[model samples]
Structures are given as structure tokens and as C-alpha cells.
Target: MKENVQQILAHFHIKQFQHDLIHWFQTEQRDLPWRKDKDPYKIWVSEVMLQQTRVDTVIPYFYHFIEKFPTLDSLAEAEEEEVLKAWEGLGYYSRIRHLHEAVKEVKEKYGGCVPASKEQFSSLKGVGPYTTGAVLSIAYGIPEPAVDGNVMRVLSRIFYITDDIAKGSTRKKFENIVSHIISHDNPSDFNQALMELGALVCTPKNPSCFLCPVQRHCRAFAEGVETELPVKTKGKAPKRVSFRAIVLMNEKGNILIQKRPPRGLLANLWQFPNDEHAPTRNDESFVKEISERYHVVIRSMERIGSFEHVFSHVVWHIEAYKGNALELQMGDETNKWVTIDELKQYAFPVIYQKIWQAYE
Candidate 1:
């Protein structure tokens, strides 16, 4: 078995593969700005921003962020609020926080330079095996394989591996194979080519095998099982949460946006204070609870349209209600009332932004 694997590896001609991939990439790869420089900071930022985000979706954000904080020193010196504001539409707020903290740590410890070694890079917050591998390969020319979803799918199809690719063990298996073949010379282009091949030609569904540079070496294509490899595990249903948002507005067009507790969902982000599980219809108990909590005289309540916002693992059924505040009082220190013009001053979750836009 070892000899057979060795024979297969030798036949693939890793250098030729890398050379062909780089040639294809130079001609066909998308013209992204991050690809223009080998700066570790830019590469690190692009890798972090691209997590759970599509390349097209991240382009504008990346350009804007790069323009705002061009260097590692600038990013390290910037305020957390500014960072979060820059990352507003990008979900997974924790990534932004981790990146912000990592910038500070890298600046203080590594003299504002992103670490080049995999071991040292992985020590930073939010830097996992994949991120470390990506940064090391792309920024420092280390022979590390950055196996992500696209790479996994592409590799599975090429090797005709039908095992459930969703398992962590399956990922490790693929990484082992990749680590063996990844070339030390220009591993960055090889890693990027693998990703681009997957994204452009070897797509999950309806892959354009004719356009693939590696089709001749693909075992799955030879076996006519290209679509069947890389079996996926079934996804669990997302948890559903229901909440009522008390949209308090005064005659002055100022809206009441409360800051949630420093932890939990939308932590420290602004939102309209309301009951956790709002009743299906109007209930006196729910109304009373809101009145007591805010300590404000409720003049009248009018129901606004409900909207559903779905996250990766959670779903929120949000019902908006316009409340008339009689006695002007900020109930909680964590909460505050801001004018419509001040909306841009704070970092708000995208779901709330949708509501605010609709309100406006």
C-alpha cells in the first residue's frame, strides 16, 4: 500500500503539478488586490476576512479596510469600535475581535510584523491550522497546505475518496495527503491554485472537468464518480429563537437603541430592548414586563412587520413594535437613546441595520 501510494505520488509529478497550477493561476486567477503583494499583514487580513465570507462579498470590505488601515501599525493602533464598524456587515463578530487583539499582540511582540513561522503564527488568537498554513504559505513561501472546504472538495474528487468529508478525521486525512505533496518552492501559488481550481472549475456541482488542468490525474473523473466523492454529513436544524424589540421613538425622531450585556448574542451591540420570547399576539403580561423594565409610561403600541434573520446555527424571529415613551428615562446604563443621525456612529448587528433601514 505504501509503495502504491508512493508510485501514485511520483506519477503525479508534484513539481510539474505546481508549475502547471501556477501557470494557470497567473493567467486565470481573479485579480484580487491582496494577491498584488506578499505582505504578511495584507495576506493575514485577507485570510481572516475571507472566513465564512465569499470572495466577491469580501472584496469591497477588504479594499475599504486596507485603505483605512494600510499598515499593521495602523490596525494595531486603531480602536476596537473602529474595527468592528469596519466589519459591520461581516458576521461572526468574534473574528473581528480576535483579529483586533492579534494585531495588538503582533505589534507589541513581533514589532508590528506578522509572524512567518507556522508555530508562532498559530499562537495568535483565531489563528488555526488552516490560517497558519495559509499565512505561512502565501506570505512566507513555506511549504504548508491550507486545506479548506474548497480544497477538500477538490481533493476528494481528484482522489475518488468517498468518505464523509464533513468529519474532522476526514479533513486530517486529506491534510496528511496535502502535506506530503505540497512543494517548498512557491507553495503559495500551489495553495492558491488548488483553491482557485476548486472554486472555478472543480466546483461542487456541475464541475467543468474539461476546463480543469488536472483532469488527467483525477481518479474520480476516470471512474465517472466526480460528483459522488466528498460525501457530506447531514446538517442539523438550526435553533429558532423568538424575540420582541421595543422600538421606542420620540417625536424628535430619536430612537431608543440599548446596548446588550457585554456577553451573549450581539454582545455589546446596540438593539431595541424587548422581551426574549414575545407572545404570538398582544399579551398584558408581556406589556407589563416591558413597562416595568424600562420604567416608562407606555402611551400606545403599534405592531411593525416581523422579520426573520437566520445565522449559521441560530434563527431569530424578530417582531418589531413602536412604543411611545412618556417619561424620558434611560432604564439601564447599558442602554441608550440615540438620534437617527447617530446611527452611523455605532457598530450595529446587520439584522438591526435591516430594521433601522426599514424604519427610516
Candidate 2:
């Protein structure tokens, strides 16, 4: 609970910063779809999509998502697979899963309303401190800190905080500072203005200090270290795993695909059957394993291509191969054969889409 919040408040011009930041935001803020209304559902969706994603990238996706599931009830009622299909290219599938789960709980528990209280709202699935703060402040006009990476960076510079942002403990320090200084009259614009400042003017590299509304108030800029204030420790490298994806086709010209396990990474999504092996392993065993496990025989093998898919914590090095299903006794319940056009119906991970691009 300890914070340099008092020191931060004592040093910064809160009143002037609030006036300049909010005035700049009201006039210069981008016409984002989420800002059109105070619907908690829409705000919740946009905030979820914005996490670890760029604003431009999220615009179209936001429009499409709201169109598809315009209401919390609609989203709650949709099938999980169909929801995944709408969110296919967004990467972080878990976000949608958690959002979906929480929305359903909201629909049933809160009578289809997103809770304004921090305790009730944060109790829902995947509703973290950042999300809770954002939805509460933006949707309900609560005076709470939505301290994400952007807010942290902005505050780090303006207050000259030298905490390592990568550390979890650093967030509380920033959050406490935000809680005390957040504008009570216009918490909505205040929070969004801070975020907008970070995204547009106070960029990570070569910040537009001259154009920044609160640049004169920035201690880091005054000290000539705007870019150096938010020190962050680098994360561990993504673990690499190799797989030989076997693409089999029947006489009817259907491709073989299987559903991933219902839990863990890429759960419940369809993908090509992989002959899991090390990168140094020979293709002889790979082909042999595919034939044995899938109950299919192949006369010839053609190396389609080599591809890679990077996730947050792992990198999949995939080597794709193709052949006619010479014989078929397909027995796995999760395995199935579908036409190329029909393949578009089931949700496939971006890596499989890359494999398709290379295959075609």
C-alpha cells in the first residue's frame, strides 16, 4: 500500500495538468468507436481488445465484434466455437474466452449489467485491476486508476519515477499515484487523456515533447531523460518446439484436420495433425508416425514448406508435408476430413493460416 504518491502529488501541478490534459483530449481525441457511448459492454470489449494490441489494429475488429455480438446477452448466448471464429486472428484467444465467460456471468448474475462496484466487477473472470479501473472510470465515471503500460510510461516521465515497470510491484506504486491525482470532475476524460497522451505525443521513442500538452510539467523531459524513466526488465525468451504437420488428402479432395485439446494453448481450435518431434529428427519417423497414428497409408511425400508461429511464451517451428491418403481407416474422434472451402468455417490459429498461405 506504500507509495511515493504524496511526493508525486507534491511535485506535479495537478490542477494545470488536469486542465491542459482534459482540454487537449476534448479537442484532439481520436474518434474511437468506444468513445461514442457509455455502454459498459462496449467499453469492456474495447479495453479487452486493446490489451497488448495497437489502436489502429483494433478499430475494424471492434466494429466487426460489436456488429456480431451487439449486446452482452448476445455474446453470452453465442457458442464458444463461433465466438472463437469471430476472434480468430486476434491472437490472445484467452482474452475472448475470459471475456465470454465473464459476460455470461454478468448476464445471469447482475441481470445483464456490468457492475460499477470494484469488488463485484473484479470478482468476475479475467477482470484484472487494470480492466476494473478502466471500465469503472470510463463507463461508470468512477475515480480509479487505469494504469496500464501507457499510463505507467506517462506517469513515469511526468513524475520522474524510476521503478522497473516489468515488475508487478511497480504497478501498485503508479496506481496509488493515479488514484490520488485523478480528476474527480471528469474521471472519464482524465483517464482517456492520459492514455491518449501516451499513445500519440509521449511515444516510447522520440516523444513529441514540444507538442505534448503537459510537457512543461514533465520532470523527465526537464531532466532530458523522457525515454529513460520507465525502466523495464526484459522477459525470458520464448521456448521453441518443432513439429512436422502432415497434410493428408482423400480421393474426394478433403484435407485432414484435428481439434486441439479442450484445455491449454490454442484449446479447442482446429489444426493440421502434427507428428511431434525434434528439429533434428529425420522425416522417415515423422511420416511413419503419421501413418500409424492416423491409420492412413501414403505412397509419396511432398515437402510443402517450412513455417513458424510465434506465441507469447513459445515459438512453433513447423515443417509441413502433404500427400494423398492412399488408404484410410481414420479412427481418432477429434480427427476429420473437410474441403478447403469448408476449412474456413472452423477457427484455425494464425500459424495454420500461415501454413495455408504457403500451401496455396
Task: Write down the lDDT that model 2 would get.
Answer: 0.88
Predicted candidate 2 versus true structure: per-residue lDDT over 15-62, tens digit per residue: 898999999999999999999999999999999999999999899999
Off by over 4 Å in 1: 1-11, 251-253, 277-283, 327-333
Q: Report the poorest 10 consecutive residues by lDDT, candidate 1.
A: 1-10
lDDT of 1: 0.81
What's the number of clashes in each of the models? 0, 0
Model 2 clash pairs are none
Q: Which stretches of candidate 2 lie over 4 Å from their true place?
A: 1-3, 277-280, 326-333
Local accuracy of candidate 1 as per-residue lDDT tens digits, 1-360: 123345446556666666777788879999898999999999999999988689998999999999999999999999877888888888777887889889999999999988887777899999987898899999999988799988889888877666687787777777777887786777888899899998899998999998888887788999999988679998899999887776777666567777766656766676776787444456466578777776666777877778899988899888877777764575455666678788787888888877776665
